[model samples]
Target: MNKKTIITILIALVAMAGQAQKHLPAFQYSKEPAVLSGQIIGNNQQITESVHVRYSLKYTSGMGDALRQTSAAVDADGRFTLSLPTGTTVDCHVAVGECRFICYVVPGQTVTFTLDLNKLETQGLANALTFSGQLSDFNHDLVYATEQGIDPETIYRDIEAKRNMGQLANELPEKSEQGYFHYLDSTYQRVNELIDNDREIGQAYREFAKAVNRYEWGAMMPFCGQSIQYAGIDTDEAYDAFEARLKQRLEVYMKDDPWANPVLCYVMWSMPETFVDSYVSHPVKLPTDYQQCHLASKFLEQMGAQRFLLTEVQKDSVLTFLPELAQDVLDYNERMERELSFVSEQGMSRVCTLPDNADDILATILKPYNGKPVLLDLWETTCGPCRLAFKDMHDKKKDLADRIHFVNIASENSDLATWQRLIPNYIGDHYRLTKQQLQSLHSQLPCNTSGVPIWVLINADGTIHHAFTGWRNVDDMMKEINQVLQ
Candidate 1:
């Protein structure tokens, strides 16, 4: 062969190899940890305020469990590293300061990225971020797809809106089933078109994106035409008939094997408890995938929490159904039980004696910390979001322990024993109030008492500084707390 011809053939061969290598390999579950390291290019003040890169994992157990967070501190130079323990490819929201974006983390791989804080602040688009290393293609594709409006959250919200208000409304039992099915098919086709148009995304990512869309629709399918009020199923007979129809639809849906992919957990994360319970009780045959087994075990784990303990029978059933995950299930149960037992035994120390008078409870609770800014957390043990919030704030609370007086208050609605048991896990001044005392405090405070996880900021001078409900990130809370401190 001529020299030029040989050189051309070699170059063509190399190009073909590069093209083949660009396609991502199929996902394999692993116990090994994944490393995510990155640098934030921004001013020192913005970097300093960005304390931690926080990401949470939701696996088989669902949202009933306390959110499992893996965080790494950002140094003075705006560099951060996180070692995430994931068994499969999972979606995570990597948040630093006010900037947050969805990224996929794969087991046993390192994905490095750079966050341009200036661009994130100015444009508020994560597409400006750059990524490299293993699994970088997946992350890049995810961000690009999200930016282009192919986001799972957006699609889910659109579906929900149509289900609630449009012709696809679950409440409209008389709506044509074929029409609804057509809508789902069209939505999937649109998503596929977006994926097809994106020539940059790999084959594995394309499949993952489509799987997410299918599973999300499957998750919501069981509720179609099953709204109790809309169906007018007031009697037991009618209720039974309605349930049977729903089960039939669900079984048909499950035939597609929606749970085969471990990554579907992302779509299922925000699903309501009722939906999960219905899924677990459905008579459809289970998938043989180990991820499916693990998810089933996690669902059982949540069910076990209803009584605050997993019974021996329940554990045995888990072992029987999920033999592949037998040891894992047992170890998780034992570890959780041990942690609960330890915390329950180590009851919290009261910072001050309760006032004999029940009136003005808020004033009485703040009397001990008159000159220190107090961040009052109102929560209950049975509340999942409340406990999750506490877990999220654990490290942040410790960092501010000396600077702020953290007080936690619970009412009679929460079990006294349970309250004592969990309070030790959160290091703060604890108080259990009577129903009447709680009502009195609510009347005095400006915050909304409609929820359990309420946060009230008490100024150093013993006056209300701020009050809000629900969970807030550490940086946002710090901003308000700093104002009160200054």
Candidate 2:
């Protein structure tokens, strides 16, 4: 063969090879699944040898829909495969453990990693090891960027400390914006530097991260908009100035979707209720009507029908006022119901009866399990710490099953359907109560704050023995329970 012919044939072969390498099949929904595998090294003697690696895997459907969480499990070392439906981007996390990581997976992809618990706690996973798969570099970038972001507590403290300055309440309108923007700008610069310097990170993730940053920063605007200095005074001049300032501040987010800008959207969503008549023309009363005026509707309009509908659904207020605007969203939800299916392997949870209030709780619920000391787990469905506490206490509950009565009381604000669905995952006596009831019960208990999952221990004599909040480890809980028992 001639030299030219050979060269052309070689070029053609390379092109064909490239095509073959890139030709991944279209996602087959549930027909195929993705796998996540990893090994945990440096497991101390205290840590279980074969730990249950459970995670709540949240992902978005390819069709641009709401996020969903699927419960997944794998042995700490048994390839730790995660089989998920196709065309999803997953954020995986152990209930309370620090194995939180994000990855975009398609059907038939196997993403793998090794986590060193010791290094993970101190140096973070970004410094510990490398992640491998198509989305590995993107995932790594996310970790690196997050590791470099400013600590939220620092900013919170700076803003809050000013409250003691006495002048800060008056200076809030001017000072908060400067402080907020300073931190936000610094965060933006740091993340942008990482993105620009890294070639491995994809353009898609870079864009997404930018959106997330904007949304986070946007949420703080509401606090900045409020006039703490002039708490109850009603002035037309102050009102006009506040409205103008808020409108000016919101220019950046005017075009963004409510979901993408959840914080800002939520503040705007609440404006109607909190600042009623503040938006009406020739407002005679409130001074900050502009902040409440037409902003939510404008945001809803910019979010378009689908996003608006989903936002309303999340607020649990759809079909109340925005039915005309939500026809498309309703249709989309219906379509998803038909097209998607989940095959959950969660076993049947032991059913427990729910009592009405603290009165009924003492009379019927607690009275029934009279002999055993009760550990009241006050939790709600959406509380992250609450979920983590429950997950961490799982094994302890199984071991200490006979010693104590585990009573889980969910706040009334929790979705009843979701509460019922999730209760099966937990082992305990379950009950639901309103905020009024929770406070009434708290007054009678040892707890100081209304926050949950508040642990309230009832002595065998039916008197309050102890109450604490936050994720108290298994050992701490055992010590408390045993102390009460003694």
Candidate 3:
């Protein structure tokens, strides 16, 4: 090869190597391109504060746990900055204790969040699974899946669409025996017919229970491990068989794939709380010792990255295994944290907030954005009211954007094009986040927007200046913003 070509190839190789490094180390900012500089602040110093946070994918996929050992600390001035994975729809939390907070992450934007302390939670799964709308989706999806016998995605989207049509939660379809799944409608009819007929999915358990009776231990293990929600109609015979089979499943899973599906096992165990109580506490219990609990916690700690499905009790039970796990969970708490400070609420500076790393840009945001009365307008493409509100607000942007930070957040579905077309100027320095990200953001605010076209205004001190929902709330919203800014 010519010298010139050889030199050119070497340069190209170096550039490729540089690009390759970007995806490694997961949350490495350059290695993983991300929105920068998240901040959490506390209003009253005398009142210790705590904030919670989680990251997520917009759709029903999985999420990454974002408590960075290096970036986990809250700041002295009551701010914490954190970096999220590239392409992550991140959620942040703010709370004092068991009470809930509001969410405020930008849709699809790499994030920098600021929250106050009055809006944090410190107990239970309700405190941990900080994603707000996710449960609504879960409940809606479960009921729809049972009724329609369809995949969770289709059911989830159906619920969203119904919401757009302004349907109430009660108005949605319920678990119907005669729907497409149970009766006849789709290719899955035959498969649906084979599952347990009992409403509680106990019928499926009965077959497995009978298998246990016949000493089909191998087959019974799977029955115990399978999703219990799908199980219908529990019986005494079924419960006993489930216990027998599940004991075997737990043994096998704990031995081999303990971390493989921690949430599923926990959920499975929780299915028949009554039966599991009897089974586990049976004369032949799971050693009736804390060591086993330690083992279970180890599995959970190792699998914390994909812990969206884990309940608080499950997470706590596992963390109780080792002191370090408890420390880490405690560490996740950001106290009176500067939304952009170095030390976390736990009083450790080991973890850094988003601003800690990208100080320059963060400083820029805080310079003028701080303490300035700001109005955050949240809307998505799929939301008709959100679109209408966007258009309505768009008419006033010339007067608003320069005075207050008016951000139009695109929901994850906005990328689908169909959702995008409804809104004008699908351009600009817009912040996009998934519903999960939005929910995570909600973990910080005093109030959250259950429906779109919501307005959240905050003062430079991070006090929630005013919060409201609805297009009609716009006038009141404007007044609040003006008062806060003035």
Q: What is each predicted model's overall lDDT from 0 to 1?
A: 0.67, 0.52, 0.39
User: Looking at candidate 2, what is the lDDT of residue 257?
Assistant: 35
**Candidate 2 residue 155 C-alpha distance from true site, Å:** 11
lDDT of 2 by residue, 1-486 (tens): 999999999999987754532322221223345666665666553133332222321222221122234544435443354555533223444321435544445446776766666686689767764677655655566566555542232333455466445444554334454554555456556655655666554454454555444544554455554424433326888667766665565554443333323223212222323322222322322122222223224333323211222455533443443333334335555543332221113232345554553464444557877877888888887776676566567667766677888888887779888787667557777787777776666666655665767888888777778888887566887899898778
RMSD of 1: 7.4
Which one wins by lDDT: 1 or 3? 1
Ten contiguous residues with the weakest lDDT in model 3 = 21-30
Better of 1 and 2 by lDDT: 1
Clashing residue pairs in all predictions, respectively, total: 0, 1, 63
lDDT of 3 by residue, 1-486 (tens): 999999999999987754532221211112243333434444555333434444442211111222321234455665554454423222333343443332323323343433333443333232222222222222222332334343322333453465345442335243322221222123223334433343443322223222222222222233322222225436878667655655654444234322222222211211222233333433222322222433433343333212222456755764565442344333332210222132123222121123323324323222445745556656665565565454345435545545666545555756645443322232123455555656655555556557776677777785676677767634754666668767
Candidate 2 global lDDT? 0.52
By lDDT, rank the candidates, best first. 1, 2, 3
* lDDT (C-alpha) at residue 303 in model 3: 32
Candidate 1, 124: how far from true, in Å?
13
Error of 1 at 304 (Å): 12
* Model 3 misplaced regions, further than 4 Å: 1-368, 416-428, 434-437
- Clash count, predicted structure 3: 63
